[model samples]
Target: MASSDHYFYVLQCADNTLYAGYTTDPIRRLAQHNNGTGAKYTRLLKRHPMRMIHLEHFSEKSPAMQAEYAFKQLSKPQKLRYLTEHSSEWLPK
Candidate 1:
């Protein structure tokens, strides 16, 4: 598949925090997160069963990484606004 089909996503951690990452397989990624061997942030949170709250697609890995970095730098309020605006399609059931 094309890189444009891949996405970087954020999950709302159990502690009400956010975890950012890039993956073409969000479902498998979520499993990895719950399994304690995903991103360091997810491992630290250890709050299994995180909810997929945001996702942004990129035409390439570089841009996806860039977006991930930018997301990480946003303030809590900004992040919340992002989630709010994107939730319609991004948020998991």
Candidate 2:
């Protein structure tokens, strides 16, 4: 089976709140979110210029989506903690 380079990502929105979702291209997805053409929830928030704070690569869309759902379930503080812990791992190196 071909491996999926799908990624589950977390964004720190303009309002400083976190949002989670899966994508094949986080940079483009984030651009869409900032442009008010992404998720309906984000579109209605009057927020923009979203910043990507976390990213996790998965082998398939299904698992990436599952990770997205699980990440979304985290409380804000918990999410922040996760971000802090994982930040260095995904940074350009």
Candidate 3:
């Protein structure tokens, strides 16, 4: 796969919660979450995910997982800030 195929993503659940994950394919991963086939955290959410709020691409899985790790350690407010500050400006809001 190309370097750009790896991604670190942030998802907003239906209940106003967030989930961070690393994936090679965002669309397929999002579908897995919606279908209850992703991470336990997402699968156990009160409802299906609302949308993916942010994504950061990586050339390797290690850095992508590192991003996911770092994102997970942030407080909710900080996470939101990280997303806004880190996401590409051209990405849809």
Please list the C-alpha lDDT of all candidates, in the order they appear.
0.79, 0.79, 0.83
Cα error, candidate 1, residue 41 (Å): 1.9
The 10-residue segment with the lowest total lDDT in model 3 = 84-93
lDDT for residue 47 in candidate 1, whole number 0-100? 71
Residue range with the least summed lDDT across 10 consecutive positions in model 2: 84-93
Tens digits of per-residue lDDT, candidate 3, 1-93, equal 366668999888888788899999999999999999998888875857548888888888899999999999999889878877887542333
Q: Write model 2 residue lDDT over 1-93, tens digit each, in one string.
A: 654689998877677777888889888899899888999868855567677878889878898999888878888778777777877643321
Instruction: List model 1 lDDT by residue over 21-87, tens digit each.
Output: 9898788898899888898778874476687877777768888888888888999888777777876
TM-score to native of every candidate shown: 0.80, 0.82, 0.84
Clashing pairs in 3: none
User: After aligning candidate 1 to the native by TM-score, how far in Å is the CA of 5 from where it should be?
Assistant: 2.8
* Model 1 regions lying over 4 Å from their true place: 1-4, 89-93
What lDDT score goes with residue 59 in model 1?
69
